[model samples]
Target: MQIDLAMLFLTELQVGSERLYKIKRKGTSLNLRYEIDGEIHRRSYLSGLSWRAILLFALTEGKAVTVHEMDQPGRYRKLFPNTLLRRLHWYARPNANFPPVARFYDPNGKAVMLLTRSRVCGHAVDALHNLAHSGPVFQPLWISDIMALRPMLGLDLVRDETFSAAMPISAYLEAAAMMGRIVEEPEFPGLSLTGNPRRLVTPPSSKAGRSIFDQASRENPALEKLRDRTIYADYSLTI
Candidate 1:
């Protein structure tokens, strides 16, 4: 929820996350934290997808969804080891249960699991893993955003403009295999929603590259309306 000096006093716990943070007010901003390791971790209740909290509200009221990730950790790199650098990953759910059962990767790409069935919503975990792990899924639009990040990470194996949008990862993988290692480390995808997100952009500032999902956020309309809102926190952005 948006807060400002003129807003009335309110207190609440946020939803759609692994942890429930008691929402706190600071000056004109709404912030929350307690027993956390550091001050860098800042979270928004309905932050991930604009309507995520809405969806969660539905789930709490008996709306059934296969996604437990509504509360899954926001950052992917943090969950993996350091050796796993740039990743070109995807999952197809072909069955009515698994809509697109397709397995694919690049010659140089080391397969990584974006969807963790073990973590799928408590009730759906067994069903998701029923097809030998074919229940994992992410949206196609997210793939497009990851493709857009290729240029920034120096994974210029193939220009996105040079390939059909449907098959952009082929170039990304071909490039990574052919020596696309501009970054030795990964950045948190959470920065896209954090107050400090400029590094995720390209040019001389390439160190902040592994943010595979930032590209999709660029086209978000809800974020577009925040032009007049100012972010006051300095977020470190990790799970």
Candidate 2:
């Protein structure tokens, strides 16, 4: 289904009261545009990495971001590997289950599971499949779970935030600059909040790219374990 996941439209008086930058999802692709001195520039991305891109962009603008959902469904156990990348959904309320439940999207973009409160609060696992195959039933997980596993997944959780008003021009451009680095990093497969476990071949290191992970490394020691593992015949981590 088509959704307006998030949009950032920056406007400032110094910029002639015009929108300096704008970003949002249409159908499945991301649409980006920016104007400077009345010259508008536009671009689009077909990557499902839309959610993460929006988060980075928002953070760059110093704007708060958040997860939003439209309607409830019959089940929250089935995994929608690509859902989290499509939209930011903090909690899932299955059918009429009074309490809204936390969820986990596939780091490799394969599934989304409804986590039980127990699973949500448990210590993070070593790999995606470890958590996915925890039990017969698919348990949901909280954002904390996702954050804990950020290292294993190659994700940066710093950009996630509650929604805010449109950004100012200066901030929008600064955010755009950060987005450029993320987009240009050859080793990074588009910024995925769930991480990119499928990254079997670690591209040559880029100092700029590694800088992004520096913050994460300082925050958690688990990230220093840069060893790789094979799961279901697929490489789960970059060496």
Best by lDDT: 2
Superposed on all Cα atoms, the candidates' RMSDs to the truth, in angstroms, are 20.8, 20.3
Task: Output the number of the TM-score-best candidate.
Answer: 2
- For model 1, the stretches where C-alpha displacement exceeds 4 angstroms are 1-48, 66-111, 114-239
Residue 78, model 1: Cα distance from true site in angstroms: 27
Candidate 1 clash pair list: 92-100, 93-98, 93-99, 93-100, 94-98, 94-99, 94-100, 94-101, 95-98
Model 2: number of backbone collisions? 13
Count clashing residue pairs per candidate: 9, 13
TM-score of 2: 0.22
TM-score of each: 0.18, 0.22
TM-score of 1: 0.18
Alpha carbon deviation, residue 164, candidate 1 (Å): 28
Give the CA lDDT, 0 to 100, for residue 185 in model 1: 13
